[model samples]
Target: MLRGAWLGLLLTLMATPAVATSMNAFRERAVTDPHGLIDAVRQQLDQAGIELPPARERELLWGMGTAAINSNDDAALAEATLRLDGLATVANDPVAAAAAGFLRARHDIANGVGDGLGEALKAADKVLGESDPEIVAWARFQLCDAYALDEKPAKALPLCRQAVTAYRALNDDYGIGDAENDVGIALATMDRVDDAAATYERSRQYFARAKAEQLVVMVGDNLAQMYLKQGRAREALALSRASLKQELATGRISDALNSSADIARAEAALGRHREAYEQMRKVVAQARTAGINGQLVDMLKVESRLAEQAGDLRQALADEREAARLGSAVDTPALRAIEVELEQRYAAREKELRISELEHANELKDLQLKAAEADAARRREQQQRQRLVNTTIALLAAALLLIVGLLALLLRAQRRHAAELQAQTLRDPLTGMANRRAFQQRATELLGSPREANAAPHVLLLIDIDHFKCINDSIGHLQGDRVLRLLTDYLRTAVYDCCFVARIGGEEFAVLCPQAGLAAGMRLAETLRAGVAALVLPQDLPVARLTISIGVAQFDGTRCHDLSSWMRAADLALYSAKSGGRDRVEASKLAG
Candidate 1:
């Protein structure tokens, strides 16, 4: 890890100045649409000579860091920020320092480190004053964000307002829309609800005009949260459902999770308690899987409240215990306050119980002074003891039942883990599709079967993304991953029930068709090509305009050979298609 870090630092130092320029270019593209800006800068970086000058190389790295930050990937953001920091320290360029400082600041913000805040704001201020209108706008917006996170919303809100003004002056609709959202966030923090709502509404309109569905979903969620806080649960529910539907329709998993949480909150408010509890449970489950301790804590709060309201005391206690466990992880002030409150409540209850016990003892002594009353008390005590014994037995039985249930759950969970591990071994993480090993193994087994020579042949088409590495390097790996996932979904639905698809390499995918001829395979390839070409990516990606190249080949009958030969032919055809301007399919000749 140390070696890798040092190497990353060296690389960053060498590329700092160039990365600054690239970041500036990225800012310009962002004025049209920050998300789209990633692709635009990527295209520019691609068009530039592959061998970049030191300055350009640094700029490209900065651009990649920016894209990673936008994608909300903290680990990637931290690595990129560290690299940028190393570059800034060695590079004399002021612009390089400014860009690097901004990235470092964002990383610090995410990690809860305050030291980077002042430096970031200072660098952003300098950049805003010295740069062109677009760069100034971008820097100012980021500066506001840093300030807000640093607990200096007083400074942040005005900067965000300024960014909005600048974008409006420039007549940049997309920039204005993004800035409007920022402004609304700042205003909301200041408790300027009316102004914030209006600002968000304006932002929503601009997003609509830009046809930016992702932006729409974001702003809608914010507005819904505001409504929920203001006791407008009905409005919140409507907005949340609408936003969730939009996110789900667009296949935005991360955004969908956010909307799902909002929907759960709204459901709780609407008195659909059972549904709300289930939804919150799912959110908690997902949060645990994702390793987001903070979200897990919040989800536990939801569960605790739901259980309390539903009169499930044991479940409520369990929820609170989970919350405490996750709370101890991050050590936030929110958790501390909750811990104190619970302790105080417990103390108060203990005192009340002590007083009640004393009063009951006094009443028992007074009753024993009267013989008739004492006789009745003796009979009642005997009856009570008998009932207690029966209750104890029942409780023991229930405990045994619970133990059995817990064991069953544990066994099921173990089995599930094993299945998941096995599946992961045979699947690609990026695309959630089959892996090369699985594909080859299946093909080998089929080939070894006792089928006749004239049995139906399986066609294999190797699909490669043209210039995939360039895409990843330029736009950031997150976007590249998104593209891969999008392609996988398209492949899954491209044909009928006769196809098997897998991502066999980083950018190489394969489709296997059972019982299909060369002619039929070629047609499938054409259909896939056309279908993928027509498919739109969820967010604004510049490369959505590009296309996939496919190489087609088929398994031979009476040959128990490895599948590599067919794979190689398909790869060659794919290469030919890419070499011939991409966006098309190529077929291999019959086996020699």
Candidate 2:
């Protein structure tokens, strides 16, 4: 067997160089090392004025987002998904937009973001209405996935049926197989076990015929899980081992660990306490390495059963305690019941397994024969598997070589563009300070905090460069901009640490202060006035060593919440300051 495997590997190595790779190869490599591939593709897309298809891009983006989550980055997957969704507005292609929406929904489901489902469902509906049958099937699959995540299995099941029907219409065997697996999962959730088993069998058959090893493994695992639910631990174990063989061949370590747990269940059912205990320990070790707490608890329960069967009461108690510690409050009823039944079986199945094993040997042999045929089919597909591996490695090599230059150029351009965009969004182009929109947003967020209500209430100070347009008429608008920038610099320099400052429309400036009352706000405003008066400019233009009239209001006792009211009150105080003569601070008391 080992010599044959080596010969097969040699043949695969020799055949790999002859295969043709597509853009999708690069896309998958981009997932593992995205900076290079994503940036290169982005540059190409920008130059061609073409966009990456929305669905694929969204999937890639979500993958990146998930990686960030896995790495414990401060920003969540929902935050990244939101940014990707915003990009869809300019994406240009309807199919791409639909795909993006689908990805957003998936990411949301993973991150427990409920808001993504409605838009994903709508996008799927839109795509299905306009696209080819295969595309429609895929879209409907995405929709079903969304519904399943949203806990709307009724909606999910019928849509999964629609996906399978669509795929069948397209004569797409792989699509049908995938849809069948989904259908089985949905049916099982809805208490239709017999139908689920039929669906899973059909799925496995179709996946096998299509040479879809991944789907075969997935569906096999699903069927094994279903068997576990039905209290057929022996069957579940057999199926799980078959799935593990495939997962192991494909290098899916975590999936293999899951299958090992299922095999442990079967060992326990067969009264092989020693083997079950060993398998359960391996499952826990693998799960710990993978950082998957979810399956660790189940593995512990199995260990508890093994210990109980061996009359190791202390070991059984320790295992039970560990299982309880790792278990979640949200475990499914089926899962909980399985644990109970396994415990009961451990107590009751001591004598019956020997007789049952003898009677079931022929059936097990037939199942093994079927599995051997499936394994032979896998061996026959070795050529295509080699092609996939070669394509993946070559794409990675090409991407690594191209990425540095592409990222450098793209990042340089993006930073320049971002500066311009930021100015437009948050600054007065002439005055170079935060604009009205920025002022209002920061003020609301800063003052709305309940913690700030007890700390000194935030102060809002509004300042107008008095008679600024008259200065603009005397000096050019260019000089007017200089005057504004100079005054902005002075105010920002004077109280930059304590204040959030913005240029609010033409010649108007605002400051937000946390931990500041009306008196403190007035003092800060007067300091701003003094700094502006002491300023100098090189223009030799007739602009003021510009002085500002200040109006200040502390946030206290106002039913009319939000920044607009704060601005209005501050404006009124500014007018009062100007009426009293410019270049001084006027403070307004909060209204009762």
Candidate 3:
């Protein structure tokens, strides 16, 4: 028997390279030509009397199964897994057997076959003591995925994290990305929103760096779903749209369907319920045609909600019923019986496992439980710290608001005080008329305006009280002030409403009429002179009458270009008026 075994081993070793080469070729072709590769693999499996090395055969079968899974060729995966199982049993190779079991478990989970979770647990047990680190990592990943699919996130998280550590240790970027994605899924399922978003980002970066476009899309889909749940519907919509585009470009119809469903959910959340219902209806049809029952049921349920929101109550009810029917159909008796049979087989094999192996597994479970407890305690502590921080922030915000309100009040008070000061600067103290500075500003603004064709020229008038020094010499200066005030009151009532009057100097006043020509200015100046002469002094005053002289100048654009030149012309006219006679009006020759 030993000699026969040695002879068989020698023959198998001789044929190993050719079989390995063929398997590598098949794997390479699987992406672009999956159906052809599947046919070739099937033919190779069926070929009789073509004995290959047991190890090489196991390697080929495992590669083929993995390729089929990646290509989504379920039929080919099932056949390859079945063949690998039979070969592993016949060859009595523990590592090969464990690898085969892991592949079968992964296949079942991917296809939503009978008792995927149970099969995964059995496969994990089979590979528990396996010396091969790669197979052990993969088994952990598969089991993690199974738990995630079953909605047991609490059970799934630790396993997924473990798989991440294993993949990191193996320096496998693709595996690390895949494991991290599962970790994100588990975290999202547990409602740890921030952690899940961070994990998904990490996974997406890893996949991007590894150039795994499909895996990146997978991570994006999960992240989009999380965003939607967080009420960030616009972000989810953008991500889902991008993912859908990539999935369609890559010919990943199933993934594209998922992305479309996510988009519909996001649209619904964004209050586009009618649009969401239309999109979800199409996704449901595609899912049904693709035979993706689990996703179809989810899509149908989403469609029902969207329909209800869209005011299509009848369609909503129909979709709800279909979803229920499909959900019930997913857990048939035949699938359950298959699951029971797998569990029984796993149980029978469990009894033959070594005591030390069982102890190691038990210890691992205990460590996991302890880790979970520690994590919970840490989370509670973090929550306390967060509450404290939030309280501090709230207090700080309130204080900031108080400071801002006080500052605003101070600013308003300063502005009001400044406005009073500005008014004081622009008014004469005694007369309450525009001062010299205010007169100059107003005249400059009037002169700066465009001169329209055939428009009336602006006029400036300067008036001076006559014999003001004699009045002060005869009476007291206080009485002279009273006389000056009496003249100011006469001027106020004498000027036209169009005139801008200002006390440009002591005992002197100027008026700027923006709509008046030289003739109007002379007329206004004469009126002021006559009005002051006609003013009656109070009974207490010694002076019997008050009088004034006036100067008039017109500011046509060609004659006076600016306020300075215009004032000079008006001052010259005032000098002529003063030289000619008191209580008289004079017009400048420079006037337009």
Say which candidate scores most in lDDT.
3
Clashes of each: 6, 1, 0
lDDT of 1 by residue, 1-592 (tens): 0001111111121111333453343432222233453555456657875565656655665765665544445554465556556656666555666777777765554433334455565565444334466566666666666655444557667676776666654555656676677666667777777777787788889767766555665677768877877889998788778876765554333445667788888888889888887887787677566554434565677778877776777888998998787555545576446535643554465466658865696566445335444454555455556764877655655555565556556656865787799888998877778898888877777666675455456788889877788889988998888888888888887764546787788888888876566788899999988988888666677575547899987777423145767777777778788889998899876432
What is the Å distance of residue 406 in model 3 from its true position? 94
Clashing pairs in 2: 54-96
Worst 10 residues of 1 by lDDT: 1-10
- Range of the 10 consecutive residues with the lowest summed lDDT in candidate 3: 1-10
Candidate ranking (TM-score, best to worst):
3, 1, 2
Which residue pairs overlap in candidate 1's backbone? Answer: 15-58, 18-55, 18-56, 18-59, 19-58, 19-59
Q: Compared to the true structure, candidate 1 yields what TM-score?
A: 0.44
Off by over 4 Å in 1: 1-50, 53-59, 70-75, 86-91, 107-119, 122-129, 149-152, 230-235, 245-254, 293-304, 312-592
lDDT of 2 by residue, 1-592 (tens): 0001101001111111222311012312322232343445344445644355554454444444433322223244355456466656666545546655655544443333235455565565445444354455556676665555445568677777777666555555666676677677677778777788788889889868866555566567668777776788778887888877865654444456667877777777777878888777777777676554544565677778887887787988998897776543334466446535543553354345446664586467557555655554554455346775876656554554355446556655865797689778977667667888788778777756665224556678888998798888986788788777777777766774656888877888888886666777777888878877777766576654667899888766463266667667788889989999888888864421
Q: Candidate 1, after superposition: displacement of residue 68 in Å?
A: 2.5
lDDT of 3 at 416: 75
Compare the candidates by TM-score and give the number of the best one: 3
